[model samples]
Target: MWFSKFFILLSVWVMLSIEVESSTHWIVTESGLIQPRLNSPFDMERPYDLLAFLNQEKRWDAIFENYNDLMKHQKVIDALWFDVGEHTNSGTQILQDKDCEKAGNINAIDWHASILDDGSEKVPQEKYLFPSAYHGPSTDVPDCKRISSLTFSMFAFEHLESMMQRDNLSANPEYVLPELLTPIMTLDQFGHWVTGVLRENSSSWLHYHMASMFWRIRGNAPKALECSRRAVHYAPRAYKDIALGSLGVVLHRAGKSNDAIIVLSAAIDHDPTSFVNYFAIANAYSVIGEYNTSLKYYDDSLKLNPGMELLMRHKYGVMCQAKLSLRIKAIRETLNKLRDELNVYTQKQEAWTKLQTEFLKTIKNGEETIEKKAFERMSADNCA
Candidate 1:
């Protein structure tokens, strides 16, 4: 009987689990952005060339799914690190073990010192890391620009060169160098490269999108807002919803809470299931003191991604505000009662003071009369 009951419970649990899973609507198109499962067609034994592979169908988004696989590809590694001679840091031990080419010619300059000093201060170069060397007209050192150009071209190859030729990069295009070099590149170089991309393809929302992110990181809210708006305006249909969501956030940062709410709400119309849109709209509502509406959206977003710690915190905060509102009301009521009692006590204290003064005057008069009688008795005794 126990075994039978356990089996019945297990069946019920399985059904409930399936129901929960089914409630989440996972779009295959959106899922393609994530890593493909093993044994999939994209996970073949034979690897693909970086340039050649990206030119394939829906592969631009799908390729990132195989980042580990791409890292192991010999051609991709050789293409990236063909120039790294022998300057390996402690971090490069794994690469050294793998016999990857070290960046010997790449100078180990001490970035911490602000000026190149002893070689000890110099950072040891990694194999895969490509520093952004692009410098724009503002800091246009001809020789440095030339070197930066050569270094980037050599590192990224014809992939970037081809992208530079394109007008619109948002339409199933490949943008690899920025992702690969952003971490290793100086902020100036990244900005310069993004600027160059924008100049070459002004219509490319991708470059503008990147510029918005770069400026935002640098704490330039106005520039970030401008770029974010431009990106949203020029974004392709595939990226429109995401761009709208980003624009909404930038609007919020620009102190346009109402616009942010409207934009984010519209973004939700485009992709209702997107937790980020719900989250952004909720934040906009929260900024305008619409706590209840914000809490509702927050709950909706939480339903989509229940485990998000940030969302949980936001929900908790809204609940705290709601609780605080009640607490504030109770405190106000208590304060009002105390104030009324204080007023009554103040009036009674004033009346009591008046009565006490009259009583003191009467006692003083009686004391004077007793003193007079004592004086008369003293005079009679003296006469006797």
Candidate 2:
């Protein structure tokens, strides 16, 4: 019985192992980079952390105060605000449903209240105020932007506008404006308002890197290249590989494959364990028809991220191309050999015909019957 149970458990374990090995998921970003999808929040990095910090209610209040202050000095147009409301049960209904027994009373019931009460009649009770229906804050804005002490509010406003344009969320009817709200802002006006603010902030290398990604997503190769170069220039030594990898990708996208290879090689030297760097360099090599080098890098990347289907697919594609090139070369060689043999055979046939003509001419002056028979025998021997 114990042996049978052990065999069954082993079989189950093998099945689970197979399932896990086959369940790799990949995502292609808007910028055309392929990456493995992270399954948990723990896998999130610094960029996501910055985004979360900027999303707090307190941060929004600070940004609003800053924007209001900016409006005093400059002829700045007001930012549009949406009054989004929550769809939920009314407060009264919530109270009724949550506390059915004491729904109408403000205080909980006391069993000895009647005994404890004095003989005097209580003064007329004031009308109880029912809780108002719940609504989302009217000052709410989409999460975007960074806060700095000097120009925090201005940057925040521009970031918000840019995000709205990037996401195409402006004029989305789901966020209805309150009737009394009167801040009129148009999409064209947003473009005019945030022109200077939309320039890439050079304060942090991470910011430039993020800007590069944004430009890539927008299909702006030149801007992406510029931002990536700045990112590489400003990145710290420890994090330089990250910036270099991004720069390489931008260069590759810009059709500078040789330059991309050089940058990606530096990235790989900085961090050999990074599979993404290997994968990127492999693609660059593939672009230049360096199949052997491309295959080597692809193999290296696959070694780091085993069982990745996308990596395998890329490696197989390169292998197919290499094989087709070899076959084409072999076919060319065979055709050349056939042509050479045909030339040699043609020359030999011409020489043989000339010799036969000379022999017939010699036989014409000799005994006609005897020479004819001799010539016929010679012809038969030559044919054989």
Best-matching candidate per lDDT: 1
| Segments in model 2 whose C-alpha atoms lie over 4 Å from true places | 1-200, 339-384
Scored by lDDT, model 1 comes in at 0.48
Instruction: Show the colliding residue pairs in model 1.
Output: 84-102, 84-103, 85-102, 85-103, 85-104, 86-104, 132-185
lDDT of all the models against the reference? Answer: 0.48, 0.47
For model 1, residues 28-97, the per-residue Cα lDDT tens digits are: 3453332222322222233233333222223322322333233334343343343222212223543232
For candidate 2, list the clashing residue pairs, or say none. none
User: For model 2, what is the alpha-carbon lDDT of residue 223?
Assistant: 51
What TM-score against the true fold does each predicted structure earn? 0.43, 0.41
Residue-level error in angstroms, candidate 2, position 215: 2.4
Backbone clashes, candidate 2: 0
Per-residue lDDT tens digits for candidate 2, residues 1-384, read 875555445434433454353223234479764333453111223322434322322332333344334433232211111101111213334344432322233233211010101101221212111123323233322111321212322211223322223232111111222211112433222222222223433345554554455445445555544555555666677666776776666566556667678878988987787788788888888778898999999899999989775566667666655554555555565555546655654565565455434333322232342244345545755698
